[model samples]
Each structure stands twice: as C-alpha cells, then as structure tokens.
Target: MNLNELLTDAVAGAINTLYGMRPSLDIIQLQKTRKDFEGNITLVTFPLLRISKKSPEETGANIGGYLKENTGIVSGFNCVKGFLNLIVSDAYYINFINNSFGNNFYGFKPPDTGAEKIMVEYSSPNTNKPLHLGHIRNNLLGNSLCRILEANGKHVIKTNIVNDRGIHICKSMLAWQKWGNGQTPESSGKKGDHLVGDFYVKFDLEYKKQISELVAGGMQEEAAGREAPIMKEAQEMLRKWESRDSQVLELWEMMNQWVYSGFDVTYKRLGVGFDKIYYESDTYIIGRDTVLEGLKKGVFYQRPDSSVWVDLTKDGLDEKILLRSDGTSVYMTQDIGTAQIRQTDFSPDKMVYVVGNEQNYHFKVLALILDKLGYSWAKGLYHMSYGMVELPEGKMKSREGTVVDADDLMDDMIDTAKAMADELGKLEGLTGLEKEDTYRIIGLGALKYFILKVDPVKNMVFDPRESIDFNGNTGPFIQYTYARIRSVLRKASDAGIMFGEKIPERINIGNKEKSILAILYDFPSVVAEAGNNFSPALIANYIYDLVKEYNQFYHDFSIIKESDGNLRNFRLMLSDMVGTVIKNGMGLLGIEVPERM
Candidate 1:
C-alpha cells in the first residue's frame, strides 16, 4: 500500500478505539505534509471533531498518540493547530527500496487479461505539403500519449487519418502541370514532399497575380480571387479526380505516392508511426454514401443547390455541411466515414482525436451528427484539443511557404545537438558512428521534451537553443544525471564491489535519502494521473523533478567512495534503482536515455 492508504488504515483502527466509531475511507483524508512541517503525511483533525467531541488540538493529539505507539509505520507525530503530521518509519522506505530494486517494470502495470482497446487518432497530415512544425507537435503528442496509456495498463491502438484529397491537393497538381518542364523528385534532386510543396507555393504566387490583374480591371479583390482562372482549374481538377477521370486519377496516384514516400521518411526520423492509416479518398466515399443514407432517413436536409447539411440548431449548434453542391466531400464528410470504418474495425471502448483547439467545434458537431445518425458509439468519441505551437519569430502559414517543414526542423535539432555536444566534449570516448547516433538521440530527446513539458491547452513558443540546453529542467540535464549514475555503478562493478537488492541489517541514512524514496514512490501515481488526464506533460515534468532530486542527493552524499561497506552498497542500490525508474519514465515519453553522454 502507498503511504496514504497505510496511514488511513492505522488511523481508522485508532479512531474506533478512541471514539467508539469507525470512519469511512472517504472521511479519512490525508495529504503530503507541508514542507514547513516535520512529517511525511498529514491528517486534519477537523473532520473527526464531531466524533471526538473535543478541540482540534486535543483530537489530533489523541489520534497521533494512538498511532505512534500502536503502528509500525508511524514512527512519530507532531500536532500543529488541527493538523496531525505523522512521520513514517525509515524501515518503510527501506523496504520499498529493497522490494523495487532490480524490477524492470517497477512503475508499470500490465494491461488486464481482457480489456477493451482505446483508439487514439493523431498525426492526421495532409498530402498537400510536407509535415510542418504543427504536425510535429501532433505526432509527438499522439505517440507519447499512446505510450503513456500503455504504461497505465490500457490496450491502445494508434491510428492516423491521412487527408490526401480535395482542393488543396489539386492546387499542387495544377501548379506542377502549369509551371514544370516535367520535373520529378529524381530529376530535381529534391525530397518528394518539398518538390510538391514548391508547386503548392508556386500556385499561390500565380493565383495572387491573377487576383491583382482582375482587381486592376475593376473587380473587388474577393471577387477577383473567386474568378481567378487558376482557382477555377483547381476546382475542376478536384471534380475530375473525384469522378475518377482516367488521366486525373493517374496524375493523382503518381503525385500522392511521391508525397507518401516523403512522409514515411519524416515519420521514421521523427520516431512516430501508425498501426493503421485511413485515407480520405477511401473514407470520403463512405462518408458521402452515409450522408445520403442519413438524408433518406430524414436525419439530414438537402439544400436547393443539391448540397447536404445537418441543422443542429436544436442541439445548440449551427448547421454543418457534409457535401457541397458539386457532390464533392469536405473534410467533415471523410471524417464521418473514417469514424464509422474505425468503429467496425476496432470496436474500441473510446475513440480520441488529437487535433488543434481550432477544431473544437468541428469535433463537437461530429459527435452530435454521429449520434443523430443513431450510432451508439458516438458517445465514446472525444476530442483532445490542443493549442498551437509556434517558434519565437511567430506564427507559420503553410500556403505562403513559411511553415517549418518537419524534415528541416529535425535536421536543425540534430545539427544543433552535434555542435553543443562537441563544444562540451560530451562524446569524448565514443567512436565516430556512436557519436552520430548519440547526436540524433539527444536532438530528438530535446525536441520531444521541450514540446511535451508544456501543458497541452497552452500556446507556447518553441526555442531550439533553449530546448537543447544541458541544464535547467531540459532533456539533456536529466539524461546527463542518468549517465552520471551509470558511471558510478560501472566503476563499482569494475572494482569488484557488488551491490544487491537485499536489504541491509543496518545502514546509516539521512533525510535526503528518505526524500529520494518519497519521490520514487510517486512514480506509479504520476503515470496513472498522466494516463487519466491524457497529458504526457505530467510524465515529462515528473522525470525532471526526479532527476533534480537525485542530483541533490548525489552531491550531498558519498556512494561508491564511502568508507562504510554497507552504506556504500545501499547507496549504489538506490542510485541504480533511480536510474532504472528514470529510463522507464523517459521511455513512456518516447525518449531515449543514454548511459554515457
């Protein structure tokens, strides 16, 4: 049992003996003692005042006295005002250290023998351009959440919905057809996504010029944009692609393949992947057919322009369109279809979408619409809405070619990691190849930790240099602490000194050691809380605090170099277990911890 549970049980027995009444577990509230106080856990005597029929101090003193003398875990107690702070025995911590030592899955629990799977959807990138900084945050959050969920003993399925169709994609295709002398990824020597993205930017440039020309000819800028020939052609291309016109289909297939190849490379480098991927081209048809089904059942209304929509005014939402007048599907249509397909495939207990906060209403309407169509699973749908992530300079616009491409961002991080590592002489003993691999690990760890440390609902600016720092609650700092512990262990092993998980008969310790044990004991709760809240930031920050505490303990005491053999062995065991938990915690955040920096 944890500290709180153990104290509650002891206090309950004491309450019945003193007041002739046993309190419910709900009435027995306990929290970590305030730092200014001298105890590990504190109980408020105010709640038990009615039964005790006495003043707060008297009630607290009575219970504290009973527990200190009657229980093995309650070493002592201090009553201040109404608060009863109980100092837990050192043996409890020592026992925890011994029991937890050498256990690889110490803080992790296995999934139930038979549990329903939770389906999480993230990294829903468009094929119109390469994945950008926004997409990077999406992928990292999704992947890390999946790991966290698994660590919390849940069966998780990681899925993606690739937005590979529609008007934006046609713009890229049309731009390439107009401006290129038949340039391909091979001929241009550019990554496929970058090549395609260039055409997307090219389309914007020319389309703007057309808008300007029309404005000069006495047309409003908005009207000019609508009347632009390039925009018209792109719209027509979308219709043809939807109808599967032979030539348009061929072109779409070729370009999308190029983009997919490029996306795979980026995903691999970013260390994120999906077990199952749904495509808009496939799901949009299913969505359109489902809309027609809804229309037939009077669940939706058809517009005079031959469009499809659902009026949610009664549900406190505005009308939402499913299909346009031209019989083409919008993003919502395909999303509906994707939801249905996944429901059939996984039959998950819950479905979560990791999208930006901008789409908060979109998801709300989606669930409502699904429920309107009489699907019982609609209630299980959730939107894990998050705020935007921007660099220090400012926001990014994808159409204007100003977005930071995922590939480019990762390359910058790795390169910056190399420069900093070299400057600090961190890779002194490693071979050339090992150094390269370590650079990648450090770079990506920095990127992931920087993004994951912030609360999901907050919009924040990401600074590359700030993230890769070797100190101040950063990834490298925690990693270096782990490496330091490993160095100490390695030296002990080399000198033929051994440390085992067995508890020593008598070993000297201090408050610092007890404090470290307290931190270690929090791992299971932290993991569970992170999973419950769908926030990997919880795990990231917890690991940082653990590293910080371990560092303080390292500096204040002697481990391998201590003269006392029992003390030395005990400290070694503690250091090793902390390192193990550090690795396990970092693993849940989808980060790597190196033995040496």
Candidate 2:
C-alpha cells in the first residue's frame, strides 16, 4: 500500500481504540498536508469528534498522540487547529524509492481479464474533403483516450465511421464529372483526398454563381438555390448512386478509394489507426430498414409527405427526421444503423462517440431513439463531445477552401521545428537522417501535446509558433527535461556507475528526494483520474508539474557527483524513475520524447 492507504488504516485503528467506536474508511479523511505545514499526510479530526465526545483540538491531539505512539508509520505529529498532520520517517521514503525505482511500468496496471470492453469511435470524416485542424483535434483526443483507458487496464477498441456517402459527397462527384476532363490523382500529382476536396470547392463556387444568376432573374434566394442546375444535378447523382447505377457506383468507388489512400497517409503521420472502419454506404441501407422497423413498431411516426421521424418533444427535444420523403436516410438514420451494427459486432460494454460538442444534441437524440427502439444497452452509449480548434486567424470553412489541411499543417510544423532547432544549435553532431527524424518527432510531439494539454471541452486557438517553443509548460520543455535526465544517466553509465541495485536500507533522503517520490507515487492515480474523466489534459498537466519539480531538484543538488555512494545511487535511481514516468506519461498523450533532443 502507498503512504496514504497505510495512514488511513492506522487512523481507523486509532479512532476505534481511542473512542471505543469503529470509524468507517470514508470518515477517515486524509489529504496532503498544507505546503506550510511540516508533515506528509494530514487527517481531519472533525469527523471523529462525534465519536470522541471532545473539542476539535482535543480530538486531533488524541488521534495524533495515538498514531505516533502506536504505529511505525508516523514518527512525528503536529496538530494545526482541528487537523492532525503526521510526518513519516525517512526510512519510509527510502524504502518507497527503493521499491519503485527499478520498475519500468511503475504506474501502469495490467489489463484486468474481467474488465468490460469499450469501443471509442472517432475521426468520422467525410470523403468529400481531406481532414483539417478540426479533424486533428478529434483524432488526437480519440487516440489519446484509447491509450489512457488501456493504461487503466481497460479493453478499448479504436473505431471510425467514414461519412462516405450522401448529398455532400455527390457534390464532389458531380464537380469532377463536369469540370474535370477525365483528370486523376496520378495525372495531377495531388493527394486523392485533396483532389476530391478541390472538386467539392468547385461545386460550391459553381452552385453559388448559378444561384446569383437565378436571383438576378427575380427568384427568391432559397428558391434559386433549390432550382440551381448544378444542385439539381448533384441531387440526381445522389439518387443514381443510391439506386446502384453501375456508372455512378464505379465513379463513387474510384473516388472513395483515392480519398482512403490519402487518408491513410495522414492517419499514419498522426500516429493513429482504427481497429475497424464503418462506411455510410454500407450502413445507410441497414438504417433504412431499422427505420422502417421502428415505424412498424410505433417507435417513430411518418409525416403526411411519407418522411419518417421520431418525436423527441416529450424528451425535451424537437422531432428528428429519420428518412426523407424520397426514402433516402438522414444522418440520424445512418447513425442508428451504425450503432446497432457495432453493438452486434463488438458487444461492447460502452460505445463512446468522440465527436465535437456541436453534435451533443445529435448523440442525445441517438441514445433516446435507441432506448425507444427497445435496446437495453442504449444507456451505455456516450458522446465524448469535444470543443473545436481554430487558428488565430479565425474558424475554418471547408467549402471555401480556407481550412488548414492536416497534411500541410504537419509539414509546416516539421519545417518550424527544423528552423527552431537549427537556431538553437540543438541538432549539432546529428546526421542528416537523424536531424530529419528528430525534427519529425519534435514537431509532431509539440503539435499533439499543445492540443491534448487543453481541456477537451474548451475551444482552443492553436498557434504553431507558441507550441514549438522550448520553454514554459510546452511539449518541447518537458521533452528537453527528459532528454537532460537521459544525458546525465548516460554520462553516469560511461563513468562505470550503475543504478540497477536498490538504495541502502538506512540512507538519508532529503525533502527534495521525498517530494519527487511523493509525485511518483501519485502517477497511477493521476492516470486513473484521466481515464475516468476521459480527459488527457489531466495527464498532460501532471507530467508538466513533475518535470518542473525535477528540474528544481536537479538544480539544487548533485546526482552522480555526490560523495556518498548510496546517496549518489539513490539520486541516479530517482532520475531514472522520473525519466521512465515522463516517457510513460508522454506515451499516454501519444507524444514521443527523444533521448538526446
């Protein structure tokens, strides 16, 4: 057990002995002692006063006296007001460091065989465009969440649902058919997604021009938009594709394949992958059938125009459409189908949709509809809603071709990393290939860290320059500290010093060493908290605080240069543990630390 657990049981025992009443574990409130106080663990005596029948101070003094006299765990005690602060002996900390210093996976728990399986769905991108900064945040949050959950010994399946069909996709297909004289990704030398994305933009431009002409001819804006020739063509294309028209189906398959190829490159660069991928084309038909079943079962109602919908008004939401009058499925219908298909395939304990906050209502309705459809597992569906990420310039617009493409943004980050590293001369003595590889790691690390460090629910303005800086709570700062620790250990190894053995049983550990051990002891809890809350920001900030503390301890004392062999080895072991925790923590955030940055 850790120090807190040991103290909790001791306090419980003391309460039972002193008050002649057994106190529950919850009543024994233990917290870290205040910074100004000279103790490691503080117990609030107010709760025990009910059983002690004494004043607060008297109760605290009685508990403190009992702990000190009865247990080897508390060597000294001080009562501050109604709080009893217990100071542990140096031997406890020395033993803690010795036990934990050699553990490589110090804070990680092995997967529990009986744990429930969780499926995390993220990066549900449309085939119409390449992923952008918004998609980057979505992918990173999903990927990091998987790592955190796995660290907490949970079984997590990373999944994606590609919005590869619908009217939006038809716009791009129509544009390619009209303007492109049989051009291909091979001929244009552009990523398939980017090429397809260009056509999406082209469709918008032409659609707008047609709208303007119709409006000039004295038609209402909405009427002109519906009547636009290109819009009509795209709508017809969607119908043809849905009917499995051979020509349209061939074109759709070819374009989608190209986009998938491009998407693979981006996913690889971002260091994320999916165990399974679902497509709208495959799921929409299932959704249509599910909707018809819901209608027959009276779970949903059909309008006079023959469109199907669910009345969520009783549940504080307006009615949501399931199928259009033309018998085409809406996004909600596709989602319902996807949920059913996934549950059948995985039988997961929970289905988490790592979507943006904008879709909060969508998931809410989805869960309600699933429950209404008689699926008992509907309650297990959760929406991991996250806030949007924007550049300093403003929000991005895909149809206007104004968004930061994911591939381009990664390239820019790498270029910025190279420039900054060269300016700092941190890349000296590295080969051309090493410099290239290091730049990629540092660049991607900075991007992922800066984004993941923020609360997922809060909107963030991503500044590439600020993210790559080597100082102050940034990824590079933490990475640089890790690299510094690694350098020290390497030099110690070169000097024929080894830290594989434990520290001596009677070694003296100063306050700095004790403080580092305390933080290390809290690593597992920090990871568990992050997993429970689905927030990587918890892990991100925890590592930063640990790194900051280690840097201070490094400046205040010597490690390998210490005169005493035991003290020197202890410091080296402490440094090694910090480095291991740093690596593990960064790995949870899907960021890598270099040994020599």
Candidate 3:
C-alpha cells in the first residue's frame, strides 16, 4: 500500500478507539501536507468535530496524538488549526526507496487476463491530402492515450478509419486526370500524397474560378457553386466510382494506393500506427445495408426524395442523414458500419473516436442513432474530441495549400534542433551520424512534447523555436537532465561505487532526498490519473515537475563526490530511479530520450 492508504487505516483505527464509531473511508480526508508545514501527510480534523465533541484544534490534537502514540509510522505531529499534520519517520521513506528503487517498471502494471479491451480510433485522414498540424495533434493525443491506458493495465487497440472514398477524393482524381498529362508520383518526383494534394488544390482553384464567372453572369453564388462544371464532373465521377465503372474504379484504386503509401511513411515518421484500418469504400456498403435494414424496421424514415435519415428530436438532436437521395452513404453511415465491424472483430468494452471538436454534433447523433438501432454497445462509444492546432502565423487551410505538411514540419524541427545544438556547442564530441540521430531525437521529442503538454481540449499556437529550447519545460530539458543523471551514474560505476543494493538503514536522508522519493511514489498514481482523465498533459506535466525537482536536488547535493559512502550510494540510487522514471514517462508520450547529449 502507498503512504496515504497506510495513514488512512491508522486514522480509521484511531477514530474507532477514541470515538467508538466506525467511519467510512470517505470521512478520512488525508492530503499532502503543505510545503510550509512540518509534515508529510495532513488530515483535516474538522470533519470529525461532531464525533470528537470538541473544537477543530482539539480534535486535530487528539487524532495527531493518537496516531503518533499508536502507530510507528507517525514520527511526529503538529496541530495547525483543524489540520492534523503527521510527519512520517525517516525509516518509512527509507523502506519505500529500498523496496521501489531498481524497479524498471516501477509505475506500470501488467495487463490482467480478461481485461476490458478499449479500441481507440484516430488519424482518420482523408486520402486526398497529406497530414498537417491538426492531424499531428490528433495522432499524438491518440497514441499517447493508448500508452497511458495500457500503463493503467487496460488492453488498448489502436485503429484508424481512412476516408478513402468520397466526393472530396473524386475532386483530386478528376483534377489529376484532366490537368495532368499522365503524371504520377514517380513522374512528378513528389511524395504521392503531396502530388494528390496538389491536384485537390487545383480542383478547388478551378471550381472557385468557375463559381466567380457564373456569379458574374447573374447566377446566385450557391447555384453557381452547385452547377460549376468541375463540381458536376466530380459528382459524376463519384457516382461512376460507386457503380464500379471499371475505368473510374481503376483510377480510384490507383490514387488511393499512392495516398496509402504516402500515409504509411508519415504515420511511421510520426511514431503512430493502427492495429486495423477501415476504409470508407469498404464500410459504406455495410452502412448502406444497415441503414436500409433500419428503414425496413421503422428505425429510420425515408424522405420524399428517397434519402434515409433518423429523427433524433426526442434525444435533443435534429434529423441526421444516413444516405443521400441517390443512395450514397454519408459519413455517419460509414461510422456506424465501422463501429459494427470493430465490435464484431474485437468485441471491445469501449470504442473511442479521436476526432476533432468540430465533429462533436456528428458523434452525438451517431451514438443516438446506434442506440436506436438496438446496439447495446452504443453507450460505450466515446469521442475523444480535441481542439485544433495552429501555427504562429494563423489557422491553416488545406484547399488553399497553406497548411504545414507533417513531413515538412518534422524536417524543419530536426533542422532547427541541429541549428540550436550547433549554436550551443552541444554536438562537439559527437560524430556526424551521432549528431544527426541526436538531432532527430531532440527535434521529434520537442515536437511531440510541446503539442502534448497542453490540455487536449484547448486550442493553442505551436512555435517550433520555443519547443526546442533546452532550458525550460521543453522535452530537451527533461532529456538533458536524464543524460546528466546517466553521466553521473557512469562515473559512480567507474569509481567502483555500488548502487545495486539498498542503502544502509541507519543513513540519514534530508528533505530534498525525501522529496524526490515522494514524487517517485506518485508516478503510478499519475499514470492512473492520466488514464482516467484521458489526458496526456497530466503525464507530460508530471514528468516536467519531477525533472524540475531533480535538477534542483542535483544542484544542491553531491552524489559521486560525497565523502560518506552510504550517502553517496543513496543519492546515486535515487538519481538512477529518477532517470528511469523520466525515461518511462517520456516513453508513454511516444518520445525518445537520448542516453547521452
């Protein structure tokens, strides 16, 4: 048990012996004592005033005295108003360190057999464009959540639903066919996704030009947009592709394959992947079948134009379209089908969709529709909605070709890391290859950490320069601290110092040493909290706080140079534990920390 649980049980015993009443666990309010106070755990005695039949101070003193006298755990106590601050004996912390130190998986729990499985769906990228800043945040949050959840001992399945077949996809294909004289990724010498993305932009530009001309010729803007020749052609292409026209299907398959190849490269570079990938083309038909079945069962209604929809007015939502009038399935249909497919495959206990906040209403309607369709697992579906990520310049527009491509952003971060490291002379002893690899680690670490350090629900601006800084709460700062700890341990080992065994029991540990131990004790709880809240920012910030504290402790104390063997060994072991926790925490964030920098 942790310190708090031990103290709680002691308090419960004290309460029963003194007051002749058994209190619920909720009545035992134990918290970390404030820094200004002289204790490790503080109990609020105000809640027990009625049972004590005394004032707050008297109640606190009674409990404090009882704990100190009855239990060996409490070394001393102080009554500050209604607060009972109990100081734990040095032996308690020493015992904690002895038991916990040298444990590489100190904070992680192995998954139990027959655990509830959670499926997390993220990076639902449309095949028409390469990933950008927004997708980066999505992937990082989703990927980190998986790690955090697994750390909490849940079986997590990472998944992606590729938006491969849609009108937007047709826009790129048609543009490629009409404008390009048989150009391909190889012929254009560009990444396949980038090439396909260029055509998407081209289609938008031509469509806008057509709209402007039609409006100038006395047509309404909406009418012009719907009637534009390119828009008509793209819609027709979608219909042909749906009908399995050999030529259109062949083109669709070829372009989607190219996009898939490009997406794999990006996902690998971003350190995110999926156990299963569902395509819109494959799931839409299942959705159509399901919706048609729902219609026959009166779960849905058909409009005069023959479109299928579900009325969610009773659930405080408006009607949601399941299929267009021409029998093409909408996004909602594919999502329903995808959820069913996943349920059949994994039988997950929970289904999580890691999409942005803009689709909030869409998911809400989806859950309601699925419940109406008699899927009991619909209630378990969760939307891990996050806000958008923008650069310092402003919001990005994909169709305008103004978004920062994920591949380009990663390259820029690495280059910036190299420049910063070079300017600071951090790469002096490293060979060219080592320097490059270190730069990549620092660069990618910075990118992932900066984006994830924020609460996922809040929109924020990303600055590359600020993220790579070596002195703040940035990833490199924590990474550098870890490297420093490793260096110290190496020197200690070379000097024939042994840290494999626990320190001598009689050794005295100061408050700084105890403080590090306290934080280390909180790692498992922090991981649990991160999992419970589904927020990686908690883990990110926890590591930052730990690193910050360790840096102060390092500056204030001597480890390898200490004259006392026990003291030096204790400090070295403590430092090693801190480094291990740091590496483990960063690993949960899908970031790598260099051993030497």
By TM-score, the best candidate is: 3
Assess candidate 1 and give its TM-score to the true structure. Answer: 0.97
User: Can you tell me which runs of candidate 1 are displaced by over 4 Å?
Assistant: 399-402
Can you write out model 3's per-residue Cα lDDT over 1-597, one digit (the tens) per residue? 778888889898998998898888898999988889988889999788777788888888878889889988898999987888888888888888888887898899999777779999999999998889889999999999999999989999999999999999999999999997888999989889989988998999999999999999999999999999999999999999899999999998999888989988998988998899888788889889999999999999999999998998888889888999999988999998999999999999999999999999999999988998999999999999999887777888665556877999899888988998899897788889999999999889988999999999998888766765656988889899998999999898898888757777678899878878888888999999999999999999999989999999999999999998888888988999999999999999999988777
Task: Count steric clashes of candidate 3.
Answer: 0
lDDT per residue for candidate 1 within 168-269, as digits (tens), equals 899999998988788999999988888898899899999999999999999999999999999999999988988889998888888898899999999998
Superposed by TM-score, candidate 3 places the C-alpha of residue 96 at a distance from the truth, in angstroms, of 1.7
lDDT of each: 0.89, 0.90, 0.90
The TM-score ranking, best first, is: 3, 1, 2
Over the stretch 1-597, how does candidate 2's per-residue lDDT look in tens digits?
767788888888888898888888998899988879888889998888889999888898888889889888787988888888888877777777777777788888899998879999999999998999999999999999999999999999999999999898899999999998888999999999999988989999999999999999999999999999999999999999989999999999999998999999999999999999999888988889999999999999999999998999998999999999999989999999999999899999999999999999999999999999999999999999999887777777665556878999899888988998999899899999999988898889888888999999999998766765757988888988999999999999999998757777678888877878878878999999999999999999999989998999999999989998888888998899999999999999999898888
For model 3 the local lDDT of residue 212 reads 99
Order of quality (lDDT): 2, 3, 1
Deviating ranges (above 4 Å) for candidate 3:
392-394, 399-402
User: RMSDs, each prediction?
Assistant: 1.6, 1.8, 1.5
